[model samples]
Target: MKRICILVIVLYVSMTLCGCFGPGISDYRYDLATGYQLICSSAHEIKVVPKSSVGIPMIPAKVVEIVFDDTFILAKQLGLKKESENSTYMIPDEKVIRYWIINAKENKIYGPFENDEFNKKQKELKISDSLKLKDVDSYKKSK
Candidate 1:
């Protein structure tokens, strides 16, 4: 009995020291219509859904990064439709227009905004450089 207990304790300590008992860190990339984003987190995985298709069953593309970063969010807002969807005629639903970003520290979202206003805000934030889209194809193919 004593030997068995010792063995179990040793195994537990080894596993804990090796980080087997803790959530492991992961790196993710997101692909958006405008560009790609990269995220590092310990969460199981990131999820992305088209703003138009929320709550509806759809195969979400394996996106790499969060879309709520300055550039991608602005792009989404600029693309929002003016009309609403009706049962008889499917007008694009403006309510579904949104962009979101999630990470260990922040869960930020951006809703629709006018083009000129959004541009001005981005410039003021000094995040315009971060908005430039990366070579998504290289990352996608490397994966």
Candidate 2:
């Protein structure tokens, strides 16, 4: 009986470490575009997947909000850069809000850029100036 118990314990630990018992996605926020989704794996982790499919390269972020037009998706996110680089954890290295852009037509994604960099890319991409990030403070208050 003791040997059987030990075996069971080992099996459970192995499964847990291998992600067989990992946290499932807690929420899914879909885009109007077919197959685009923002999945909240946890409060601190959001994943942007192409075609709503896992295993493809995705943008990892903690999203405050996302807006979409016919051509593009703009998300106001935090921890995007850190999450993308370090796949092992979902913690935010910095609490800074950054802008990420996705070109729906091309199926391409752009940076978790700072204000200056985002502005530069904004012009280069010809993203409409009217597309604005909703104020983070206001979002928090409303929530």
Q: Evaluated with lDDT, which candidate comes out highest? A: 2
lDDT of each: 0.38, 0.66
User: Mind sharing the TM-score for model 2?
Assistant: 0.59
Candidate 2 per-residue C-alpha lDDT over 1-143 given as tens digits, one digit per residue, 9 for 90 to 100: 99999999999998777764555534444543445665665667665667645554456666766666787777777754434665765566565778788887777778878878878988999999887765322321110
What lDDT score is found at residue 136 in candidate 2? 26
Model 2 misplacement above 4 A:
1-26, 52-57, 80-89, 94-96, 135-143
- Please give the lDDT score at residue 114 for candidate 2: 84
lDDT of 1 by residue, 1-143 (tens): 99999999999999778775443434444443332333222332233434353442211222222223423332331122334454342233444433323221122343233445555656665554556423223344211
Give, for candidate 2, the lowest lDDT window spanning 10 residues: 134-143
What are the candidates' C-alpha RMSDs? Answer: 13.7, 7.4
